[model samples]
Target: MDDTDTHLLRLLQHNADTSHAELGRQVGLSATGVHKRLRRLREDGVIKRTAIVLDRAKLGLDLMCFLKVNFKNNLASPNLDELHGAVSALPEVLECYTLTGTNDAIVKVAVRDHVALREFLQRFSEAQSIIERVETCIVLEEIREGNDYAVPKPQ
Candidate 1:
């Protein structure tokens, strides 16, 4: 991607709701040009679906935790895909990452509170057929939108 594409991505990442005129001004393109590029970006999958950032706490997800999961076997093993698929299907399981460490996979999960977390943990733990073990860290704060101005500052 060239500078314009990079700039577009940074801008969209901050606020997908930005008007084409506003996006054009920041990137030094005409609105029509910006619109075309944005379309192409979406068609080519350079840009995924635009989304809004929701307030997690307000949505009843008062807790944010990262779960480091250790599987009983390696992903390359023939039977491991079924096990991983099961883990991924759990709605509470958010982002899942295959890792290179003592842990086999990492996931992000959010819940209402400690009690709910404990309940979910117990259920997952008891499912000895798929999960091996998990470690979780409660997030206190996060910087999700700091790259806001990394693109051309909205003009």
Candidate 2:
């Protein structure tokens, strides 16, 4: 992708609701041109999907925590698929990523309160026997949370 495509992505990242005309105006492209570019980006999978960002606090999700999961290496064949499936089945788990360090995976979770968190953890631990240890850290304050990535500034 060129500079123009990158600029369009940056604009959309800020506000997916921005009209094609408005995007065209800012990027110096015609409305149709903007549409074609966006379509191409989507087809190529650069623009995966668009959805609204919600306020966790407003939704009564007052607790945000991270879980560091370590697996038992002694297992001849770890049931990684089962662990992943369990994680995916839980709505409270916002995100999960495979790690390269001591932990096997890191999970981001959000819940209403401590009781809910404890329940979620209990279920999670029980769901997978391969889990050796799960360490949790409650977020005191979220400075920033977003999917935005750095794009080159428009000239």
Candidate 3:
């Protein structure tokens, strides 16, 4: 990834719908050149699938909560994969991360209301063999939320 490649990535990160010709104009490359670079980036796995960002509230997912989960055993335990599979299968789970220190994992979930939240918790409780305890925090408001990332210059 060179400077031009990084610049293209940054532009695409901001708006995936930007035309190749426009990107080329900004990055000083031809449309075909821009297309080739983007193709290479996708093939190299540097660029993941492009997706549209949806409004959660408008989609009826009004409640957003973060769940801090503590596992019953070590992270290296055999049941780790089982827990991961289960979590990944949940559509409500927007993000799940393994963590160090006190919490074993943190899960970001979106639901319709308190009833849906409770239902999610009930389903989560089925994995109690690996999960020791869970702490929940409801997001009252979202000041800013985005998945955009800054593309760093190549070393």
Candidate 4:
């Protein structure tokens, strides 16, 4: 992508609600040109689906914990797809990943309280055969946030 594309991404990241006209002005392109560029970006898979990020506390997810899990056997020995499906189905599991080394999967779990988290942990430990052990750390605060692009400084 060119500098124009990077600028576009930054604008969208800051506020996806930006209008096509405003984007054209900011990116030094006409409205039609901006539209065509956006279409090309989408077709090339550069732009994913636009979504709204909700506040976890406001959404009733008061607790957030990061979990590391180890598998009983080789990476592919257990059904990875099935494990992913099962974990994704749980409302509390926000994110899960397959990794290298001692651990198999890392998960982000969100719940209401310590009691509820412990209950979910017990259930998860009992049901999944591939999961050998799990270690969790609670999120105390957000240190850095994600940004889709970087804004240029004034000359």
Candidate 5:
């Protein structure tokens, strides 16, 4: 909303565990003021939800891949809801997005290994009958992965 609010959000983005007092100290607000502002931000939908970021490799999920999917049926005639539901039901799929190119959708997936990846792909193929082709690119290294977004400055 204001400069102080923007600053608070930036601090929280870096570390959601920041105490109200610490946030207040950095933003020059009282502890109660900081708490109230944070509550207001949450109520106003400025802050969606807080979550913990995990290390995929540490969790034994060593494979990360991007899948480009194309449909056999005419794009205008396909059952979009059923297709979306099928993709959403897969646990290995981390994210999926609609595209404007030759492919219909791009999906980010994570699995334990190549064997698991094959099984996941097999299930993916079975999930939708309209699938024409799927191209996969495995990630060798992830330099950065985060949900951070640029916070606009108050005018």
Candidate 6:
């Protein structure tokens, strides 16, 4: 991507609702040119689907917790696809990733309150027999949460 493309991505990252005309005005391109570029970016997979970020707290999801999970079986021996599929099906689990360390995987969960979180954990534990232990850390405050990434200038 060139400088103009990088600029366009940065602008879209800040506000996906930005108009093509406005983007053209800022990037010194015509509306048609901006649209073409954006289309190309999307086709190239540089630009993924645009989505609205929500305030979890306002939506009654007051609890955010990170769970470190260790499996009873060895990592190489277990069927990871089954584990991932089970975790992904849980509504409360926002993110789950396999990690390299003491824990086999890490999960980020959002729930209504402590009671809800407890119930969610109980359900999660029951979902998979491979889960040996789960360590949770409740997020007291979220100072910053964003999906934006830095777009480097073309070399």
Candidate 4 stretches greater than 4 Å from native: 147-155
Model 1: CA > 4 A from native? 78-80, 126-128, 143-155
Clashing pairs in 6: none
Kindly list the per-residue Cα lDDT of model 6 for residues 85-136, writing each as its tens digit: 6787899998888889899988999999999999999888888788889999
Poorest 10 consecutive residues by lDDT, candidate 1: 145-154
What is the TM-score of candidate 4?
Answer: 0.86
User: 79-130, model 4: which lDDT tens digit per residue?
Assistant: 5865776686688887888888777888888899999899889877766777
RMSD (Å) per prediction = 4.1, 2.3, 1.2, 3.6, 1.7, 1.4
Q: Model 2, 29-115: lDDT tens per residue?
A: 999999999999999998999999998999999999999988886223455786778898999999998778788888999999999
For each candidate, the alpha-carbon lDDT, in order, equals 0.75, 0.90, 0.89, 0.81, 0.89, 0.90
Q: Poorest 10 consecutive residues of model 6 by lDDT?
A: 74-83
- Predicted structure with the largest TM-score when compared to the true one: 3
Which segments of candidate 5 are over 4 A away from where they belong? 73-78
Model 6, stretches more than 4 Å misplaced?
none
Task: Kindly provide the TM-score of model 1 when superposed on the true structure, using C-alpha atoms.
Answer: 0.81
RMSD of 5: 1.7
User: Would you give me the overall lDDT of model 2?
Assistant: 0.90
Write out the backbone clash pairs for model 4: none
Winner on TM-score between 1 and 2 is 2
What would the TM-scores of all predictions be? 0.81, 0.93, 0.94, 0.86, 0.91, 0.93
